[model samples]
Target chain A: MPYEKTLEELAARRAAALAMGSPKRLAERREAGILNARERLALLFDPGSFEEAGLLAQSVRPEMAGRTPADGVVSGFGRIDGRLAGANAADFTTYGSSSAETHGKKQGFVRAACEKNGLPLVYLNECAGGRIPDIMGAAGIGRAGEGGRYTRRRSSPVLAAVLGLTYGGGAFACINADLVVMRKGSVLAVSSQMTTSVAIGEEADPQDLGGWRLHSETTGFVDAVVDTDAEAIAWIKRALSYLPDHANAATPVQADHADGDAAALLDLVPETRAKTYDIRKAIAAIADAGSVLAIKDRFAKAAVTAFARIKGRAVGIVATNPMFKGGALDPDACDKIASFIVLCDSFNLPLVFLADTPGFLVGLESERRRLPGKIMNFMAALELASVPKIALVLRKSFGQAYLNMGAGRSDTTAAWAGAEISFMDPAVAVNIVYAVKREDDPARFEDLAKEVAKGTSAYDLAAPFMAHAVIDPRETRDYLARHLDIFSRRLTGAIGDHRLADWPPAF
Target chain B: MKRTTIASEITGKVWKIEAAAGSKLAEDDPIVILESMKMEIPVSAPIDCTVVEILVAEGDTVAEGQAVAVIEG
Candidate 1:
């Protein structure tokens, strides 16, 4: 596209494109190598197909009257890849994107646009929390909804960027989102680290306060962390690639498995006891390549809570790796699993559990962390999960861990087994009940312990109807394909309620 | 220029070192492995720096938040 127009024509076109207070800010953003709000909208939406709403709305306060800044937030409807999407921007530089009826109109408009049009909402938030003195006191408190969250029913995925200090209402937008990306050195916190540190009487490092480490590694809060705003935009594309414009749309892609026999999936797990292998390897081998996005990798080393593609179809993979501290659920691990299950269920993704846990981790730390509470929540999540779920005990399905993995009755359970389902490891069971001897009387104790541990093996549990079937380990992939095929999604999508969207980001 | 050292986040014995002394390293290269609660926790590099020295070896118990080695940040 060559520009040969006259200077006056070019200026006219530029003036029209700049909207209200966008030109000066756009120039500043261009100098900083940052995309302006309108530029971001161009990057997100389909070219030549953006129709904005309230492009000229502004503040209504007497002190700030005549400010046609669109209340510092822009709301519009556009088609992205032929799918309708709503876009909104909070003008960080303008009145702190404050809630004084200026941005309120656009914020509510964005929420309404998403709900009414069945489109994902995209928010580019870089605000100084909510407005201070203005949004305070009785008069300020009166316009409170503008200061907080007004969710759009989770009808469509909401993606947000915390390019700067994502605090107060800005941070809430990211937290409440289905996917959030934080730029390096930027933060996503309830309040700035200074506020947190001052309250706690400790020095604050952004990375230590609302830092990337706190969310990504410690709390498992943000979905992704990138070094730049550009990468954040790219991640938004990737996240949207998995989801539809709305729940009403059938999955865009079908399973890659085609007509079955995606090779015997059972051989993925090794038969050896001591040799530890990565459970992710099995997931990748069985599922489509590059489709698995693991969540909370560092928090729960035992359980692998990941979103993967089985046959190109989206599914949540919850598998326990015995290699990681013998794949025993700890309090942290339980919280991770429960939250993931609820999330996947809400998103209408099928759940695939690769069980190989010896049960919840025991000892002082587990007890102190309130392991029982974590386990109860996990049970509740599983009970409430309405998505298609299939659990496979790859090995070591000892004790309560098996039940937590969704075995036992079929009220909402689809417990199938690989060759290695057990009540408990013979050594542990003996130590607990009969007790393993440490030399001298070791032979007697080991024999006694072995008898008790025999209950840990798969057959013992199977006879009691704990595990529905004990299929060979190598037959796992095939069995999973068959089970996921039969599971239904009729009920989950009909209601379209993801209550956990507003739930706390972490345990 | 000053050097900073990243340490094992938890109390444990050093299990292994994934980086060699004097080797050029990235920001998060693991210097040693700490064994705590029967689990292996990785002690990562503080910043982009050369591994100037190896202060602790495998099998050495280290406390939580304890610096295991120094690196030019």
Candidate 2:
């Protein structure tokens, strides 16, 4: 009892820090079905596993002393599903969780801890940007970027959840993360509507500016959108289940689950060549039961990129979706696939490309979106990935999309018995080559088209060894499982060089 | 009741008309099938509704984002 007075003061200060903002604001959040910063962290980590850091910290400003609890953020390290991880959640009740000198330091502490410990990092973002008056001067602005907030090296898996109105710093964190999930009504924008209206001289709705629909469908920044905060948290946990703890660690594996009937692929995919079906069904049939987690599922309907397990091991699947744009590779699809490739390669997950594309889309709109540059970026990421890659030509793999979808770029290239590999459709080729349209000269056009299509079959590609094997549609599941086991990194210990680890997460 | 205008998501020639103007359709029911890039793409119903109008006939070419049908739910 020698330090009785000191201990009493400590208790009082801790009590004040624990009481975030006020009772009124906390009750309002609860009524609105939103989770507080501490609640979010509690839900993310296992029970009784979180260890708090900077709990007694407050604002350095004399005028704001004792007003900002934990410097407007809650940060620390904990175990997520029994695996060590680090996190920081913005305390919106405290000064709107605005960025300040002390707030930035708290986030920096968690980031540094994750990097040092080689653990995954989760960011529960709900902020209102930089604090006014405090961060107005040049000196204050200089301290804002002190912690490398914009830098992402993929040293560890980074996931973000936008559970409320997130702006400026919070929005940047969401975009820079390897995977982002957002609540349906939340907004993630560079600036709030007030500032945007002042700068642009036009009022913009928050939903229109950076709502979940915009990010999910247009910007392609968010990987998934859920109806509630708990749902968003669940998505983050599910995504982490398929990734390694860090860049240098081996991917975790679980007991193998039974796969869906492989014969279903024969019916899921039409052999008639011109018929379209949902590629998701085929993906589900090939992967272990209930292991497919589609990424950016709403953004690029023309292509599908997902994380799945085969024989209990993690893998990345990039397949063409024939239901949209005739399964062509458009600008958005290219960006989505390239970003996903970078994530999987960083985590040492082997890749599988189920190619059934007509080719890259060509048009005035595609050109305006810089399709050429996007295609090159996709190819670069594909080439830079050091993990094992297998490209299975399921139907049509034409033009540059053939190479882009693995072909010579992958470690193993195979095709179904009815797959086609051609520069263009034979009917279109005949019209261009011989100047004979089907309507103009039906018999001549038919003969020329047949002749042109002679060397484009799956057998033709396998005969010259362009395709390593020609398989049956029913054998797809078994073929991928066995080949993945064979090409798995027995010598390298299943860790990749991570050449695309530093690639930008957003296009 | 809400009135909705369904649009074609891609540029293609209409290959088949699967629903009539007075038909009641469920969500995701194929209203029209289009041929583009040598593949059949369906323009499905966005919601459960009664088709009010079919804007184009089979064999007519439609641009992407063009309104193809009207429905009342």
Candidate 3:
């Protein structure tokens, strides 16, 4: 039949591509429990959505003739989920997937496809680094940097995944991605552990060179991280799900859910103040169930950030946990919060702030982390976020943090509430006010502390209208829902152009 | 008097403007927030000044070099 010939021809071409880049060595990729180029493409793209290009591309060199799988790069057009997505799969099996003149051609190939087609672009990077022998000459490097290929190709969004050791070119591309998700235990850096160690005269672990810890926690590099191959795929899928197929269109499809009664939140907060509970519990009960996917769980344990749905609408949740270090905004916590704010604003996710900060961290350690700059940056992120924000002061908000958390200013507000906002902690205030008396008149200090604390309580701030409204802790669920409704439908708000994705993974 | 233009570093449309034309602003006054790379990068005034012009609309794809607003000091 005519169909049989077409199928047979397709198989021959695919087999040829795999073989070009030293098919035998592809086993190293398989050994790591990851899929090969074709398999990965198949898994990533929606069923029957891929239409590949340059299948039989090969090496130009005579000695390397008939070799180079898809010219060591899998460039193609595919639909990730019925929406167009263009991509490049660098073949690590050929010359370590190093960046070479020939390899650079394929890079341009995929980037051009995405730019021209108006589809989101991705790079499945698994490389050893820059091509060694070919990159030795100045002309080779010059040709490689021709025409500002990466910099000029900024019209479309680019995402990357690091599934194996990514150094040299691989690392650059991976880090430059708008959104990067890397497999746990994999390394990504400017140089490999051995190479950097040899150069620096130190014993280096690749994990130290670029581990999940280095990028995610210390430097705020990679955006989202996953533990398994499946999670990596799902993370990519989920990220793309929220974004439009291209920059020109609307956000992708998301299902709607009915708004629930505020009564369920009557028992959301614990009756006792001292007892601690998971903040995620309150978040899930209020937002669309099963849609609260929290990002950056390991870093900044004090504040929590996640993508969720409030009545099936995409929302960004930023909350504090008094259970952690009294919910003080430390440097780590500030960096974590500031980055999340940037991400949500970029993605058009409206914000829900659950404020419970006693104040920003004080003392020497907090200062060492450059807490002032971090706090200012956090405020800058908040000020820059033109998206709708509904701030609820859950328990305690004191000092300058009260204003920074949106208690003052009509900047971008939908609603505000539920807090005990004051100048300082009454206990600390009382000690300073009566420091000379505690030893001479111990009972007097106790009475004064209690009286001052009551005046600065949640009710006092509520009566004065410093906060929008002070409600029962139980009302936080419905209160947020009402404001979130008002924020997301705003057609008039300031939004900047796309730039953050290529910021290079932090570490 | 010196004037400066601050731009966003994200891939999002300009969503909101905190400063208005003719409004006096202090150093680091937030001018605009760009929604890009899944984050909001705010462009602010570098010094105390009065707003001269806002270059971006509510929803504009401003590149790194693209000015969101201009402030005259």
Candidate 4:
């Protein structure tokens, strides 16, 4: 009676649009151990919560008609753990999900929607670079430039999961994300090996070009690596649990229901300073139980960076792993800590520093790797970060690493009873000053070391106002929890301008 | 046979050789130990192999990434 025929026609078109690329292509994707675009969205979002946008969008040009379904992407709003989130998943089954004018526009649309709604954006990137014919000539070039440009100004978090052979625009989305999770076998690169080889006249395998190991260990682009898409999605959900929904919003507090004895930390650190112990044990004892999520753990062995909660409040932790290089900061460690700091600062997360370092790594290899440049860069990041930082000298905080770890940069700083805060190790300092090694003059070296050690003890520094307090090891949990409660207010509103909110992740 | 070099990750003195030359080892077995920053760090074989050679003697200084031993699988 009232345009019923028209309504039926619209319904028929929608059904056809949702069918995606083809049954054969979809089956091939499944056989390859990859999830279909729709399935990926289903896994990422809460059940029945997704409200798709641009579902009926097809190719704008007549030549590309009937080929691009949803313009090669599936974008929508959904809830992740009941918190609103946005996603744009590339439909690898459709024209290899390569970016054309429409694809880029759709991506831009979803990104803008996420920004406007203050929802976290997740990109399920799996594509074969840019579409060839659709992106040729004047009009096409203008549209390409107009879309898929990442400015990094969003207040809400942007995360990416590289699930397949992601290149070109896919690579951009993954690399530019605030944090990225990559599937174990997937590769993310600026261009295909074939294209790169043709352009540069050098050939290499795809895995060697942009494999998970390279991104995770060398470029530091990937924050986590998992064996499956489901695992990656689960990780993304868990990561979001630590962040506020948006910049103006307060950080979410869930009943993580921390259940562990804080006093366990008293014995976590070894009584003898020379012995190596797992810093994770000390961290677990002090942080909210079961809330620690370590990032890049295998890459930078010396610098241990993780996200954990203290009394249901989120905080970024940068600690030294005495088990590796005696907690010395190397080139990899510097990059790791610097990126972690930027991430924490971007999301308005407070920083907690647990420092015990001999010094920056030194030698021919270190110099060859530009250790000084990396250290200076890390120091610059530490100094520029305006987040509320709480520092604790667990045992040995020596040399330039002492200041770089926020001993002097933090809002609240403390030291353990046995912690030593000095320019260098007492023995090393004596040798440098007196031009004598332990083998040369043991007695004089011992005397000079003792004299220098007297001035560098935690008590001496606390007495002279160099440190705020010299507390018992067991008091660490209570002190940090209380400080976090006081500083939690800094995570909301304009208190923190989020100076690093738009910082690029490539560095 | 594949030969893998075990390198020291820190600039330090060779504290000890955990496995003698020609000894058999499984994956992740410590071949040599280096002492730096008053900490003992073991340079371990990445895979099951037999110790082919020990390059540095105990008390000898080795730079970071310096080859400390070689293992053959």
Candidate 5:
């Protein structure tokens, strides 16, 4: 009879804790079109798959007894698209999802569980920073679980979604995550605008403070922005589908591609070297249809970096957009490529460089941006990458940019018949060498330009074994598909070291 | 009716001015093109509006997030 009574008490306590927050508060959240913590979990995971772990953990602070349910954080293991994942959704209705001592400990446990079980960690953050009194003293200051510092273990992927106001611990987790997605109207920042305004002595509007526009275009903190929580969840599922469950596992592959005719590749790039076209068209032509997921697209216009598939196998793609600064490598573009290469190398994704760049941007503005340091950083990352590297010269590959874009010693090097590999543009070379203007000595200038361009032709370079093949522009998709398949099956002398697995996503 | 300012997303030279002041434009109509990173990014009207002012010339250098043109709906 005592055992039955104890079991009944346990069930009652669990039910009370799981109720989350006051009914009025829950109604307010719903009125604001925000999903409750439990509802977020339901949308994030497969039906009937969530097994919560901390329903009985009430806040240890005596005054807050029965006030904070699940310590304001509902954490557990669940099936995300049928694969196991560790997840936590901050219960904003409970004390504004403030960080209490028990909540921090639970989060640390959740992150560790994901690492130990070889599952991804997913965080749905809507926290309002730390609970003031709970974290005010020396004991509170020393607490380790308040932020995402426990996520240092890189054995599993950490993904975060900011659904509403996210400050302090919640902001730290999102910013530290490998990939972060945010809802349209959500705010993500180090501290709330109220606190920030008080500290900085300036009025701050929530709309302009760490908003979607700032993160997406200016800061690049968010990877994707969605209109609703459901779309954010869908994006998470899609991103997970491209990657393995853990860093140690193999990447997933899709077997079919139904993109339009591959022959359309010939029309994507212009015949005139000076004319600019969108390289995304060429990317679509070569990769499996609908498989190109671009990274940092809004940040660096000159470089097109994306994760794509060729014949179902995953690959990292880097291409120069000749339309932008003549496809030159600027400071921002250099950093973009370097970081992307590191990401692919960490995950064992083979790299494909579509070379159409003229060279590095040269000017006072470039110097001000510390182009030399950025160029060196990019070169180091490219040289250190251990994955199979392929370079395809579609039009122009000039000066040091040629080597940086995977020309020399890349596993496979190919060029279109019309491509040119040159030390610099012949026009620029002519201007530097000749004292007379083109109008004064038109014939001599034209002759000198032709002479400078002689050995730069793709056919000429291929004859000397500089390039492996000079292919027709239309055959690009077929050629890349064949080579990627060959490279994927190559014999490895040792397992991949995955050195960049711990690289900070934002830095 | 409300006024909207079209801003540049990057630091670049003004390559071309596509719309003149007082011209009526549909949503997404180009006002001016900024050349940066060797690419042309056309600053477009957010909604149906009339070009109220053109601030920068073709050769002018503009900083990121700078408003280069004004439009009134």
Candidate 6:
């Protein structure tokens, strides 16, 4: 009872900070079925595990001091799936959870702490952008940019979720995150519609400006689109399960799960080169059942980038989806796969490249998109990746795409008996090398095409040791599982060199 | 009834028309098989619907994002 009055004052301050915002605003959020910042943090971390940081902090501006709770941001460290991680959730109930000087410092503290501790960082972003007037001019804007918020070294995995209208800083975090799960109704953009309309003198719908669909389908920014906040958090947790807490840490491993029927791969992938099939089916057959988590799934339809477990160990799978563009590696697909390689390599997850590409896409439009440079970037990332890589040629691996898909670059390379490794498609080669059209001289073209295809078979590549082994289609899963185990044994502690750790998260 | 225009996802010549006009189709049912990059790429119905029109015939070239069929759900 000696310091009762001081204790009372302390409790009063804590209560005020904990209250978050006016009751009416909190009630409005509840009515709208949107979780508040604190609630989101609760859902993100384990039960009673979150240790709040800067809980007593408020706005630095005198006028905004009493109104802002936790300075419009809640940041702390907690166990996500029993691994320590730092998280910052923007409190939309207060000032629309806008990024201001004080909150920016708090978020920076969490980020720095995560980096120092070598822990993953998560940003539950729903900010309204830089706080008006607070970050309007030179002094304020300079303070906002102080901690290198936009510069991501990727020392640790950074995950973000866009659960509501997210602009400027929020959008930047989402874009830079290694994994981003966006809620369906949320909008993520550099500026909100009001600012865009005023600046451009044209009205715009928020959804049209930066909807989940736009990011998922066009920009390739978001990894997954979910319907609810819980689903988004679930996705983040699931993705994090596949990654190490930090770049130097050993990749996480789980108990061996049932392997998908490898024999089904033979049925899923067509032996006939002209018959296109969904590569995902083959992927599912090759990976452990129910362990494939696709990244940028909706963006680059021609490429499939996913994290899957092969015999209980995490692996990154990059496959060509023949269903789109005849499994050609276009500029977008190249970027997608390259970014994925950077992620898997940085996190020490071994990579599995399922090659079935006809090569890079051609034509004026593809060139205009700078396909050559993108192809090189893809190859560079693949070459720079220090993680154990295993390549499996299911059908066709042609031209530079074969290298891009880890043919010679992988630690172990295998091809199905029917796999074709070629500088170009045999049919196309016949036209170019022999100057014979299929329609003009069907019989002669067939003979020449068959002649051109002679040295492109899996046996042809194997005879010279270009392919380490020629496998049966039914042995695809077993081949990868065994090779992954073999390659893993070479690693001192299942950790990679992480050569691509500093690669930009978004291309 | 909601009308939808099914678009070809790639530039290719129509190799085969699997669904005819007025044919009832289920989701993912291939309406036309396009030949591109020496592979048969199927342009399928996005939803369970009835084909109202076929915009391209077999061997006709179609550009990417080109509307190739009309359907009503």
> How displaced is residue A214 in candidate 3, in Å?
3.5
lDDT of 1 by residue, A188-301 (tens): 777776677779887877767787878876776766788876787777777776676765554455535433233444555556543345677777766766777776676667
* lDDT, candidate 3, B1-73, per-residue tens: 8887766532355767787899898986678765432223456677899999888887777753566787889
For model 6, which pairs clash?
Answer: none
* CA RMSD per model (angstroms): 5.5, 1.4, 16.9, 2.4, 3.2, 1.4
- Give the TM-score (0 to 1) of chain B in model 2: 0.96
Candidate 4, residues A1-507, lDDT tens digits: the string is: 799999999898788778889889999878978788999999999999999998888887787677677878998889998988889998988888998877887888889888888889999999898787777778766667774366677478888999999998899888778778999989999998999889999898888899989988777778899999899999998988888777756666666567555688767788777666779878888888888998887777899999998878788999999878888888989989998998887777889999978878777778888999999888888888877889899888888899999997888789999998888888777878878788888898788878878778898778878788898888888888887776556534424667666655666
lDDT of 6 by residue, B1-73 (tens): 9999999877779999999989999998999999887778899999999999999999899987899999999
Q: For every model in order, what is the number of clashing pairs?
A: 13, 0, 33, 0, 6, 0
Error of 6 at A215 (Å): 0.3
> How many Å off is the CA of A283 in candidate 3?
2.1
Summing lDDT over every window of 10 consecutive residues in candidate 6 chain A, give the lowest-scoring window: A489-498
What order do you get sorting by lDDT, best first? 2, 6, 4, 5, 3, 1
Q: What local lDDT score does residue A117 receive in model 6, on the 0 to 100 scale?
A: 87
- How many clashing residue pairs, candidate 3? 33
Computed on C-alpha atoms, the DockQ of candidate 1 is 0.16
**Model 6, native contacts kept:** 0.73
**A-chain TM-score of every model:** 0.84, 0.98, 0.85, 0.95, 0.92, 0.98
- Report the C-alpha displacement of residue A107, candidate 2, in angstroms: 0.3
DockQ ranking from best to worst? 6, 2, 4, 5, 1, 3
TM-score of chain B of 4: 0.93
Candidate 3 residue-wise lDDT, A1-507, digit = tens: 869999998798778775645546667657767767777777778988888777776666656646566666777888887778888876777777777776777677777777787778877777887676667688867876764355633345577777777887778777566567888887888888778768988788888888888877656566677786667767877776655545444333256675544455546655433334456667777776677777776666667887777766667788776544445667888877877776666555667787666677675667777989989888877776666777766656678777667665423332223345578766567767767345567788789977777766666665666556666655655666676665555554323343332322332
Candidate 5 lDDT tens digits, A1-507: 769989999989988987898999999988888789899999989999999988888788898887888989999989988899999899988988888788888888888778887898899998899888888888777774445564464577778899989988889888777678889999998887899889998788875888888887667778788999888888787766666777667666676766534688777788887667788888988888888887767766689888888888778899998655568878888888887887777666788999998788777667888998988888888888777788999998888899999987578899999998888877667877775446678999889888888888998779888898899988888888888776665465212457766655565
